[model samples]
Target: MSSAGHLYLHTPFCGSRCGYCAFTVEVGVLDRRDAYTDALLAELAVEGERMGTLRTIYVGGGTPSLMGPERIARLLDALRPRCADDVEISMEANPETVDERSLAAYREAGITRVSLGVQSFQAGMLRVLDRQAGPEQAVAAVDAARGAGFESISVDLMFGVPGQTDELLDADLARALEMGVDHISWYELEIKPRTALERAGAALPDEDWAADAYERIVGSLEGAGYRWYETANFARPGHECRHSLGYWSADDYVGLGVGAVSTVNGRRWRNHAGVDAYIGTLSSGVPPTRSVEHLDEPTRRRERWMLALRRDEPMDMRWAGPPDHPEALERLVEGGLIDVDADHIALTRRGRFVQNAILRQLMEYA
Candidate 1:
């Protein structure tokens, strides 16, 4: 079971592209989804040999739910050999693609968790983001997921979106909490180059406003009994995402699909982003990897620190510590940015806000 670890499969088909998305997703390619899935399965069959005892599986997307429930069942069936007896199977779905039947089929096929992408409930914000699903559909998807007997349900919300005000964000968060979901992934809207958001010609808020929004989100979520387990994630007590925690803990995981990234045993690789190339390579029994990385000890430790700090996990000073800025580290500790003791150093609540700055110092000084 320990050897099995984690698996992340990226399903890359979407009905319509969002303004802010930078993912490798196929639009109007639903007709070719099955071919993509076939190639995905072929790759999985090869990878499955090595992950015969998987503990966690995350099916992220373009939109996994768009694959239809029957296809989803087939994907699960292909992975059953690798799945652990007690596994946490998580799938990302959008509101429009979900229904009672699909949710029920997903539950029947061993999907234990559903993460619905409900970017915003505000009508205006949804329009600005180019999201097809309405606020009511978002609520209904959660209800159907819960009714289908999923062990846990998570909702994704976007902050820093154009036309999003604090009141609107508050309303979105309130609706999420009202649904009684177990987990939430709240992320700021990042405008990538060549994205529709950039072409939309709206200036984003400055860093100060973004920080203020983060503070409000943290306050609201923590007040509602949710643990800010990761920089952008919250959950009730035990509902934290197991797959993500694995990465933060420096455990090895495999990513299977077009545009997927896999890191295992200090070696990392990424698959080709183009769908045709991905399918062609796998169909011919060749790996679709476009690049590979070898993470040496120092690199791994640095990566671990960066990942762990975001989760507020304690780091052992013996193996991981600020080696360079002895004076700066002390200054930060004195300034209440971090909490330190003999064995471990952790970010205090105040420190979480300046995590990026601290992380940069830790890496640069070393």
Candidate 2:
């Protein structure tokens, strides 16, 4: 047993798929919720032994809130005994899928944190992304989460969407700050292959404009007393997402449910993505089919550097192993792209904006 302390659970049901989403998800599957919950618990019974004293558990999804509080409570009750005393259990939610009553039930069910998917507070942007929630619903969700007394409440926002204007971005930012949530994940929009946005030939803002937008987002959030803790994540002091920090720090984790991926003791695997297959196999007392990959030392080393550099903290080179191009350090340092002291190296403020380019120069792949 690897005794991995981090865990992730995926719930794949969604009312509808977003235009820019490429995640494994099933729409119009509300009737299968009970079966799916049973499958998750069945799978966890076998996988639970692989975990030891979990420090964090993130329930992510197509819309985890759609699972309803009763199902969530059942799942958490099963996992509770395995969790550490101060474990952080987080879940992702869609704004329109939650209400004050439901959020209160979720909190009572042992979910300490809630991350609402409020991609944009602008109605036009929401329509462009095919999000069912409007700006008012987003606000209502946040308010409801707060009223529910969750330990931390976060929202997911986006930049670089088509037809986004400076005023629109400002309005979104203003609304987010006004909400006073504990954390925010503001990401640039990407047109993933096979997604509705990509199929429709949706284009993102130009690189220069996108870059400027990112800078503005960072500045605005930081100005509002939020720490730009990670490249795309901002948080108040002591509110950083522990589950995500586990991954960036190269810790092993177990993932459950259909389409979930896990890494433990240098081996990684992804469960098959079919909902019916997952449920059927688990119900039959068999683990779902999965594809496994064994990670090499060099591969893990490169991953360490890639994930660590995304944070504002220093990376311990000794733990990360040598970069492919160690000789590039002096040049990067002299160019003010990074700062190095003995075995610890960190990206400078200027370098973080062009982090991808810096990674390309330091590692085999960016």
Candidate 3:
């Protein structure tokens, strides 16, 4: 089998957990930074054998920027030799955790792209989300990433937030547009189970209102010359996030660090989610503990269809395999929900708005 070309390194350190976050994260582990980096390197040494020339490397969080440039540089230095010449290296940073000098250092260390976690621009909304960074800090972080000479700078925003009104969302959009960032990941806030938001019974905006907000977000970004390349992602013509595209395109990828998940050669595994366990096992010269699953052909095929439909492009039917309900395709087309060509099928603009519902009628999910 061909080696995987995408890599995702998870850094689980966070100063404090967010109200909406449920990611594998370790808070108050500042002292474990060095050990964590060591663990990641050790894991990479083993996993790297399965990786091909890396096309994309994504350093995601609990706030990867909190690891500081030195740790990141060491990780990249080790990864550089295995990377393609034009590999895209991206890292996610919380605005409160980055600055101009640190961002420059991160750039010098080999990160080509930086995605700032600017969840919202309103102070009340930031508080509701329990974000540490203020509006100005998010702006400064973007400016810093730009000044640091990053090839691309992206920001994350949220809609459907508990207190997010259209005016507030418009303001946030205006701020993002004003900054002229290269990309934006505007996601709806979901009150996931066990999250602080869910526990506190925080309610989201009405579904109809959220739908309108999503439309507005898509329209504003597209109007500003950005492409709605994916469901929740907008970018300038060539600044689309290649790392994320790799995932949507169903490319094999290797993931490193505690709680990181990898799928390669039909086998998927997730490393155990304890930092101590990860570090100790790697230090003992053994692979970290993990839960492994072998994906079946039907599972993979269904996933390919689901992921491909999320993009604003045609899904090659030959590659994706037949849908569970081929008859539904004709019905969907009649309803203007999808466009089907001889060998490919794609969602219409209206269909994209209810992608999940379409997927449900077209396929089965456990």
* Order of models, best lDDT first: 2, 3, 1
Pairs that clash in candidate 2: none
Q: Per-residue CA lDDT of candidate 1, range 198-231, in tens? A: 9878777777888999999999899999999999
Model 2: residues >4 Å from true position, as ranges?
Answer: none
Count of clashing residue pairs in every prediction: 0, 0, 0
lDDT of 2 by residue, 198-279 (tens): 9999878788888889999999999999999899999999999999999999999999999999999999999999899999
Superposition error at 251 for model 2 (Å): 0.6
Worst 10 residues of 3 by lDDT: 142-151
Q: How close is candidate 1 to the true structure, as a TM-score?
A: 0.95
Angstrom error of the Cα, residue 62, model 3: value is 0.7
lDDT by residue (tens digit), candidate 3, 1-366 = 889999999999999999999999999888999999998999988887899999999999889999999999999999999999999999999999998899999999999999999999899999999999999899888888877888799999999999888899999989989999999999999899899999999989999999999999999999999999999999999999999999999999999998999999899999989889899999987999999999999999999998999899899999999999999999999999999999999999999999999999999899
TM-score per candidate, in order?
0.95, 0.99, 0.99
- Candidate lDDT scores, in order, read 0.86, 0.94, 0.94
lDDT of 1: 0.86
Error of 3 at 131 (Å): 0.4
Query: RMSD for each model, in Å, please?
Result: 1.9, 0.9, 0.7
